[model samples]
Target: MSKPQVLMIGGGMIAADQILPSLYQLQRRGVLGGIGVCAQRGATVKALADVEMIRRAFPGHSFRPYPDPATAGDAPHPLLYKELIAALPPRQIVIAAIPDQLHHDVIMTALRNNQHVLAVKPLVLTRAHAREIEQEARARGLVVGVEYHKRFDDRSLLARRRYREGWFGEFKLGTASLMEKWYYRHSNFQNWCTSENSDAFSYIGCHYVDLVHFITGLLPASVSVYGIEDRYPNGNKGYLWTDARVIWNNGACLNVQNSLSFPDGAPGTNAQGLSMYCSGGDRGAWLEHSDQYRGLRYCYTQQPDAPGSTMFAEPSTDYFQYVDTGGPGLEVVGYGFRSIDHIIAAILRVESAREDQRSTILDEIDAAGVIATPSNSSYNEMVMEAGRLSILNGGREAVINAHEITLR
Candidate 1:
């Protein structure tokens, strides 16, 4: 079978850091055809194309930048992705790595174009939108996978298996945190992650929320989020700090704290981890993951040029890292790359199956639960919707009953 062409709908930090390189590696291995990336402005795409790390790592590999990077002016072309999606051949792949609010439209566009989609976490802001996408994709026999990279982490997979086997018992209570560096206040996040659009919990904290479900199979039943509003360097206000309480259906509680307030000089890129306490009748159990620090510490002679980088670093080997394997460039390792590769491989599996059996293959993919799909992961959207409503309403409790979300 011929390889399916790939189109990336966003060229921001994720594209440069994880998605594009993963795609380049697949291209290197002959798993993909031509790859193209389209962004709001030519400058964003150009910046991704000019990333020195990517150039050195991938060697001769590059993506076709949309809007003609040379002639397209500084003005933003928000609808340009529509045109590019329309032109792609049927049953190709489209990666939606845009903002939280824009995921619905871009994903819908891809599905309408007869394309398989791999979206970043928190697929959409609302459960209704997630259901809509799920229905549309299922009707057309297309696969829609959410890129919750944490699920691919070995720690998470092991915990999931053990927990299911009654090793960790029933999760009774937990705490999680994922605090990004303070420098995020100055990045493009200042423009989009505003008070009206998203908050710390809805943005980064959802990882733990999803992780909890991915590990325990328990659905979040209620959410309450208290957000602290702060001004970015660009003077835009956002919910930069947040504290949330999530109650599972079985009466378990998970407290999650998130913020863009980690000190710039901190040893790790970010501080993140999960600790869960479970019950097993006569005994108790526990699970903990210090994800930010992976036991490797380095006191470099010189600090890196990136903002907020530190001379003393505790690099995480489980997320995304480039290591020399005596190759032309570098080999990308970690759960980040593995997550993207897994979704693409699932797409390839469906495509390789007989046309009449494609639906069955998609069903099996969803049932296997290895890769997150709208049909199986819509609870994430429900939690996001609940979090947003609670944060906006002064931390009122938002109850999720059946498929609806309401504040109390």
Candidate 2:
């Protein structure tokens, strides 16, 4: 059978930084095939530049580009969707890394075309859209995945196992804090930073939202959110910080914050950490990853940087090694790489089955054996919209239902 084709939608940071890099890595290992890209006419230059880089690096591979104009003379020109539908082969994978709002439209089109899809989180902006995407994929026996990459992290996988084994006891509370340097928001994503499609919490908080659910198997029943815009523009312009208190149906509270207001002098590009408390049966267990260091911290100290500088000390290092090959080859593992490799493997498996007259079943299980399917994104979609509605309703509680979302 011919190698499966790859079509990447959107030429965003994710496509350039993570997705394309992983694809090229797969190509290096002899697992990838022809590649295609689609983006808006405005993004053509960037998209083509990326394609050219890949083409030059890996010669002899077919790379096609289709730039779509938002509108034409007559009907709306969804050139990307039209071209994809008309030409996407059965043995193909569509990586949807577009803005959050367009996830539903682009992903649904791919699924309706009977192509396997890997959509970046939050999969869609609403629970209904997630359900529709899932239902369509199931009906066509196609695989669908949401890029909740954190779930593939070793710490996250460990937590998931402990939760499944009832070792974490009854999950009582989970608090996650993550912040990116100001440059990321004000510069990196400046284009659509405040377009209502992307926000600090919705974009970054989706990781923890999905991670908490993935680890504890709890669903966010409602969310009470309070958002603040410190330096960025306000009122549909952009949000610099967001804090949400989510109540899970299992009587667990999840506190999540994603701030794009980190000080410029900060040491790292981003800081992230999560702490979970539980009812212990035997002895209390504490697991936490130090912010910025990504390792365990033992103590803190106070030492001034300058006369008026803030004194801070975290006795930690980037010593925690999740995977070490001691070199580079096909068995080298890291959850980030594993997550993308999992998608590639799933696509290849489906392609193999189709070619050998075997059943075409694209399993959704991750490397950790957890069920990391796209349907699990329903809660993510809910929490995102719930937070948005909460902000719109003056920071009141935004209730969510499995069937629909209501702000009260």
Candidate 3:
């Protein structure tokens, strides 16, 4: 069997930061075949290709840009990804790294084309779409993995194991926050993450929601999100700040706050962490993770040219980074790369098996719950849907049952 060719559907910040570099490393390691990237505009794909960090980290590695890198302009070809997905060979990989609202269509396109998928977090905005994608992929015996990279973090894995072993008792109350830097206002987020489409909670906050479930086998029963609307630099209004309360099935409550309003000059890239307090008989246990400050502080002579970067920074070594290890090009390391590698490996595992055994492999991947498949992680879609509903309706309570999400 030939190595699977990989095509990324969106060339945005995530594509530059994690996905593309990870793919380059996989290509370098002979894990994957040719790579391609399709974006709405040629400039976006060109910019991703020209990223200095990626270029320095992976020399002699590049991707086939969809809009034709030779013709450089801001012309938008919104439907180009459809053509590219159709052109790919069956049983290859198609990565959906686009906006939150666009995940379903792109993922369905891949599945319909008989291509496996690795979608960004919060697979879709609703459980219905998730079920649709799940049924489609399962029927075709293809894998669809959601990129909840935080689950790949060793801390999360350890906490999950320890908690399940009765070390931390049962999760009772928790709080999690992930705030992006203020500079995000000037990016394409201003256009897509508007009042009508999505909010900060639905975008970044879903990580913690999913993480809580990943750590403890609890399902959210109700959610209420109060969003504060603010305008971007482009004069478009969005729910820039959000505070949410999620009630689990065991009557546990989790408070999640998310925003793109963190000061750019702050020492860390963003403010994020999770704190869970539990109880058992007369004993109480606590699990706390200061995700933003990873115990490493650097004072540089000059501030990095990267947007929202500070001269004195608390950099996280766990998320994603490039390091030299006696090689012609730098190597990509961290949980981000691990998450992508895991999903691609799962796809390869399924593809390598005989046709009759492929279904069993797919079933095993979903049952293991190590990777976030549509079948295993559709609760995230429920939360996203409830969040959007609550945010739009003045933060009313949105209840999540087995079948549907309704407001109270």
RMSD values for the candidates in order, in angstroms, are 0.8, 6.5, 0.8
The lDDT of each candidate is: 0.94, 0.68, 0.94
Residue range 333-404, candidate 3, lDDT tens digits: 999999999999999999988999989999899888889999999889999999999999999999998778
Which lDDT value does model 1 have at 407?
Answer: 90
| Every model's TM-score | 0.99, 0.80, 0.99
Off by over 4 Å in 1: none
Query: Alpha-carbon error at 279 in model 2, in Å?
Result: 0.8
Residues 1-408 of candidate 1 have per-residue lDDT tens digits of 588899999899889989999999899889999999999999999999999888888999988998778999998899999999999999999999999899999999999999999999879999999999999999998999999999999999999999999898899999999999999999999999999999999999999998999899999999999999999999999999999999999999999999999999999999999999999989999999998989999999997999888999998899998889988899899999999999999999988888899899988998888799999888899999999999999999999999578998
Which ranges in model 3 have alpha carbons more than 4 Å from their true place? Answer: none
Q: Least accurate stretch of 10 residues (summed lDDT) in model 3?
A: 69-78
What does candidate 2's lDDT look like per residue over 59-83, in tens digits? 4444465553333223323455557
